[model samples]
Target: MMNDESLICEETANFTLGNTFYRSQSKITRDLGVLAAKIYKSEQGRLRVLDAMTGCGVRSIRYYLESDADFIWSNDSNPENKAVIEYNLGFILQKNKGKITYKNANNIFFECFNNKDYYDFVDVDAFGSPNPYLSTVLWATKINGLIYVTCTDGRTGTGHLPENCLQNYGSYGRSHPAAQEQVLRLIIGSSLQEAATMGLGIEPIFAYFSGSTYRVMLRLLPKINLSLDNYGFLGYCHHCGEYTTISYKQLGKVNCYHQQENKYYNYTISGAMWLGNLHNKEYLKTMKNLAISLKWSTVSDLLSIMIHESNFPPYFYTLGEIGRRGKLDIPKRSQLIEALENDGFQATNTHINSQAIKTNASLKQCIEISEKLINNSKVGKIND
Candidate 1:
């Protein structure tokens, strides 16, 4: 068993994390970095961001240190974490001469500013799930602004185990890779649907998965339609595991049932577009580039495995090779075999698409190999 103290140190040393954050190394940080770089280059409007659960203040610090955001507010439920965040923010303020605030508050319902129109970006990074904090996060974000959310409860959201999708997001069944991807979509969709019920409109522009966490960065657009029925759930076939997405347009609060058993199943429909694969090429590229640029070798390797092992088509390549016109150099089949063996992976190569490729390797093996590569590279070590 991993000692709690050791795990905490591992996380802090590796990611410069503070206690109270859910995960040690967050993919949300990398995604935010990419988003920040893009927004900084654009130089559109003065950006105000809120790190809702500012455990260790890593996310807030990244935004303040790397992004062009004018003002950042970091908050946490724990007073200790709040103090740590304040200490970190003090350094940032001294260095950048910027405005940053640290607060101890339960973000589930905390009102940070008297003006409801204060924040442009609100990031919700929670331990288990982001569901409980949805309403407050939506209220905090300005209309047409970006809202970034990270859900750490992969087991429940990704359909790895039996979870009531309807109860969670007022949506239907889940998909495999699709379930994992759509989990965030449904969360965001449910939030928007709830807001619309109160005569508000928000459209999701971008969403993706990073490591164990699934993130959605959305743009709250102009209020076009205000109706709760705009979003609904989906039901999955328990037997075949086929996706059956139902929307408010089609099914209105109908209980999801299994056809074979002829019994009401604990399932409900979710987002309008919940029936699809999770891997988005553009988003994957952006994430990969950001991970590499950050020198996060472990993240880069894990992302490579996700892309290679996932159902993504062969046309997709790593960011390093994307858009380069050339005959793809097929590495010697022995190279993969040797690498797998060296990394303690029980893997073998098979011919697919007339090219030698590795197959049938367990996810555990892939992770071990990735970790080995990262440890050897030592490119991702951060200051404590």
Candidate 2:
């Protein structure tokens, strides 16, 4: 039992009563709060929300208190967590007249199966990779409903060896920034594929990375008249740096390069590179707006970095302006190429009108380039 003194604080009072609840809220949760608040304030209709693996019901409670969600269902497999959820909802129920339900079940798989009702918004916050619960969440969500997912298995999902991630997620890839982004996308894609098998379609609307966690928000769209199984994976050799992009149907083979050549070899095939741009313009706009509203400086900084490197226009700009403008004012195309070379990024300007650049470097050269860009302060801003 939580001590009585622990219950008296304002912060503690806002959360569910339990030893298993999160000690401090995560950035992902806080960001979710901002998005949920926006959705609640914008939409006038009744909203039904669910928090699978509610633990101490921090997410569910936030929705109850801050949003117009008519009903909030909080569930956890642990009895103690359920009890704490009940304790936390007491004050919320009294103040907002909101309906809160607490249930005990294996939320990783079974809770959605038992619940007959479909929710407008479903939040899944599992302790690790959320792969186990994707099917259930898909089933229990209403068509066109929003689903928020948090994957906490960063060490294995996003940060692990590419081969290890492939072995676990049935998709493989390296742990570079692009690869990490793809891993999260692959996990979501796998879930969407499963849902598609059941005649469902999901449109991912937002995704972002926070410390050790990748959160994605998707909307379950109606089953459009189309087949969804036209995606595949890419395998890359870590030793020789050779890459092969192949479909799921072509993934069965046994080749032991180590046994044949007596050298250490590793490769990863990941599911997230879905052969398309993951974020559409609308989604990017929403993310930009959310970032601005929340004053997320790091996200802004990363956006700037990505824009400078990719030579893409600002998120808020129109395509016409992007095209009509001869060049972006922030980063000269040539400077970006040089920066990419200095940072060891395999970048080449494929712009038909621009010059192409490529590099082949030894391991030592790659290390030096990386260190020079990341460690040395003398490399002034490329955009400047």
Candidate 3:
């Protein structure tokens, strides 16, 4: 009964999703993207964007309406979506503010490069691995421009598929308690590696995980930023539940200190991934201020957590892991964080995992602290 004449409309933020593929759950990411784009525009004095996977053209509409993008090029491979995209972005198209194209994403990127039409911002909302566009998108991105790349392939990135991880991220992935966080780091590291191939570097503007999806916004630099310290591996001890950074030179030396009698343990090393700060604190602070000005309380709160956990290690320990390792009941996340903080260990909640904590303290230290807190609670109850 449905035909091309049938009109379908949905609303998100300030735009209408016109008969195109739309996911309501992805609105938060679009919101964050709009905020980041607005901030980029304010600082650079102009904003031209290339939405490589425009879908229903919602993002293009938001970029134009919310971020005040000077120009936007929205592309989707499905020619059938052209009418919907145009319908959604009609106003912008009529005003010469944007263009719509039906072409493969890589073809679009190649075209941009061939025509020397670089964008100040490029958003690639890729399904599964973002590896395909990781290197190609840079060709369309201006130096110091922002690239918002996304990956929904949790299985591959989380180490459930080692072969796929290597093929996609160019790194080994291993399943661990903190594998979700590892997905974010893998994307950043892979992006860095791709950029380095072009004699360019990237700085992490922000790294975000929205439950199942992993996203990282990076600023392309004119120089290469790949080095031993920042581009490295992570060694997680299966025996003791500890995490440590491993450089390229230290690959053969990855031995866990958690020795049993005379037996030294080997760590499950996962990397050739990013070991750098996940978010730029100053930039996140600026984003938070913008969120505050807009009265977006939820966004502000999330940004606050991201800023706090930015300086911690690349991995986090879930309360479940701490409990299992200690042979005790799962400690309350809030109480554990409080105890860790009081004991001079910098511990905070990670937005990546609600039940986890990012801290400078070791897993053993965390377990010990949890025991003391639980015991103290018992003693207080007895006295009462």
TM-score of each: 0.58, 0.64, 0.96
Q: Model 2, 271-306: lDDT tens per residue?
A: 544443343444445545666665766554443333
Every candidate's lDDT: 0.52, 0.54, 0.89
Error of 3 at 206 (Å): 1.1
Candidate 3 structure quality by residue, lDDT tens digits, 1-384: 234455443223344445566777877788789889999999999999999999888788888888989999999988888766776677888999989888999999999999999999999999888999999999999999999999999999787998899999899999999999899889989989999999999889899998788888999999999999999999898888899999999989778874456667898989889999999999899989998998888889999999999988999999999999999877889899999999999999999988999999999999999999889889999999
lDDT of 1 by residue, 1-384 (tens): 222243233222222344554453564454444454346334455677777766766666667556656676766766755545555566656766444444433433356534554577777766667767666666676766666767777666555544565566655434442455556556666667666665666654345455576766665656745343434455543333233445556665555455577876544333443222223345445656767886867656545554443342111112112112222333334454566677664444221112233333432344344445545445546431
Clashing pairs in 2: 144-220, 166-171, 171-269, 171-270, 172-269, 172-270, 186-272
Question: Per-prediction RMSD in angstroms?
Answer: 13.3, 10.0, 2.2
Q: How far is candidate 1 from the true structure (C-alpha RMSD, Å)?
A: 13.3
How close to the true structure is residue 101 of candidate 1, measured as C-alpha lDDT? 41
Residue 337's lDDT within candidate 3 is 91
The runs of at least 3 residues in candidate 3 whose Cα sits more than 4 Å from the true structure, single-residue gaps closed, are 1-19
After superposition, candidate 1 runs with Cα above 4 Å error? 1-24, 27-29, 33-37, 40-43, 95-110, 158-164, 172-177, 225-235, 238-244, 252-384
Instruction: Let me know the TM-score candidate 1 reaches against the reference structure.
Output: 0.58
Highest-scoring model, lDDT: 3
Better of 1 and 2 by TM-score: 2
Model 2: residues >4 Å from true position, as ranges? Answer: 1-13, 16-18, 23-25, 40-44, 95-116, 158-168, 172-178, 224-230, 237-268, 290-384
